[model samples]
Target: MNFLKSSVGRKVLMAITGQLMVLFVVVHLLGNSTIFIGLINSYAEHLHSLGPFVWLFRLVLLAMVLIHAFFGIQVTLENRAATPQKYAVNRTLKVSLASSSMIWTGLTLVLFIVYHLCHFTARLTSDVASYAGQVPGDVYKMVLGSFQHGLISFVYVAAMCALCLHLYHGIQSFFQTMGWNNDTSLPLISCIGRALAVIFLLGYSSIPVFILTGILS
Candidate 1:
């Protein structure tokens, strides 16, 4: 209980959960990229075949999201309370915009995640009707049909931009919290983080863009 209340412990928890979420994003992007190869339906079917285990995985992910958000808010508020005044030197100016806006970005991501789950996973929109009469789990058609809408594709691209900014800060913060960053390696790690964030942004954003442009149809 004491550990849970400690600042360092909360940071550690955030780091661990953040890493798990990152891994999930990477794997999810890779799996969804099968759309480019015309195998997304197969991929979706394989995931559906997981049956009860998929719900178990989703429960674990939900727990991670909640815990991470709770601790993140607690830590951020604690930091602000501890300072109580602006930094004498305004050191935040030295950091990247993404690093400075972690709280806002995180909150935005929470909303985006909820919308994404409804749009893709729950298929709870009228848009799903267009893909009805297809195979039972024709996720590819659903995805394609959904993205064909200018507004939906625009929202997806905008959310991905937010994701990119969030990831750019998150990756470096994860390493620092884990005690893996050092003066000599910090620059390299930051660069790698930015690179990975861009890659993810492009990879995920391209699907919607391509669909909207009729390149992937």
Candidate 2:
């Protein structure tokens, strides 16, 4: 209990959960990328074919998100308390935007996750039940229908931006926390994080951008 309560322990937990979520993000992007090759419906079908295991995996992801968010907010608060004036100084340092805004970006992602689930998974945000019926093209049609709207696509793109910024710092911190970086490796890790963030930003945002612009339709 003491170990878990310690700052180091909490940071270690954050790193673990963050890395797992990063893996999910990468895999999710790849999965989503199938749309470019016209196999998104099949991908969705494969996920659904997992039966109860799909929900089981979703539950696990949910748990991971909750844990990551909880510890993230806590650590941010602790950091702020430990250095009240640091943030004011950090504001002028453009390079530290991702690190300083971790809490805000993280909260944004939480809201996006809820709305995303409602939009795509639960289909509660629109009347797309017809496209989601027992048909092979159901998933693809539903996604296409949703992204056809300008507002929805904009929101998705914006959320991806937030996700990119969050991961930009989150990945770097993960390496630092896991003791995977020294001075010599820090630059390489930073580059890796930035590169991954850019890939995610482009990869995830492309779906909406292409659809909104009619390139994906």
Candidate 3:
């Protein structure tokens, strides 16, 4: 209870959950990349075959996301309250845009995630229904068909841009919050984080672009 009430505790919770979510993102991208190699259908089927475990995994991921978001907002608000006044010297010129807009980027990602679940996971949208076939588990077809739409592809690419920004800052913060970085190593860690973020952005954004352009059909 004391830990939950403390600001440091909240930051620690956010860091742990953020790292877990990052891992999930990497795994998800790798799984989705199977589309390029022509194995996405089988991969999707294998995930579905997990039956109850799939739901269990989803529930765990949902819990992590909620906890991460909650603590993230809490910490951001507390920081603002602590330093309500802007620095007259304006020393933040060195900060990256992503680091400065964490809250906004995070909120954008939350909205994107909800839309993504509805569009793909729940298959609630007509866009998905049109291509997923009578069987609900044809995830490959669903992904390919949905991305064929120019607007959907654009939205996905835009979301990936938001995700990249969020990730670049979040990864560096993760290391900092965990007390794993020192003066000598912080620069390297930051560079690695940014590299990972760019890689993820390009990898995910390419899927929609490839699909829409008939490169992956």
Q: Provide the overall lDDT of each model, using Cα atoms, as 2-decimal numbers.
A: 0.89, 0.87, 0.89
* Model 3 lDDT per residue over 97-187, tens place: 9998899889889999999988887777888866444334667778888999999999989999999999999899999988999999999
Model 3: residues >4 Å from true position, as ranges? Answer: 131-136
Give the per-residue lDDT digits (tens) of candidate 2, residues 1-217: 8867999999998889889989999999999999999898889888888898987899989999999899888987887788657453555556588987889999999999999877677766764656544534577677788889888889999999999999989898998998989999999999999999989999999998998899988
Badly placed stretches (over 4 Å) of model 2 are 86-95, 127-137
Better of 1 and 2 by lDDT: 1
RMSD of 2: 2.3
Candidate 3 clashing pairs, residues 3+ apart or interchain: none
Taking all chains together, the TM-score of candidate 3 against the true structure is: 0.94
Worst 10 residues of 3 by lDDT: 129-138
lDDT tens readout by residue for model 1, 92-140: 7687889878888898889999988776776677887655444337888
- Ranked candidates, highest lDDT first: 1, 3, 2
Candidate 2 displacement at residue 168 in angstroms: 0.8
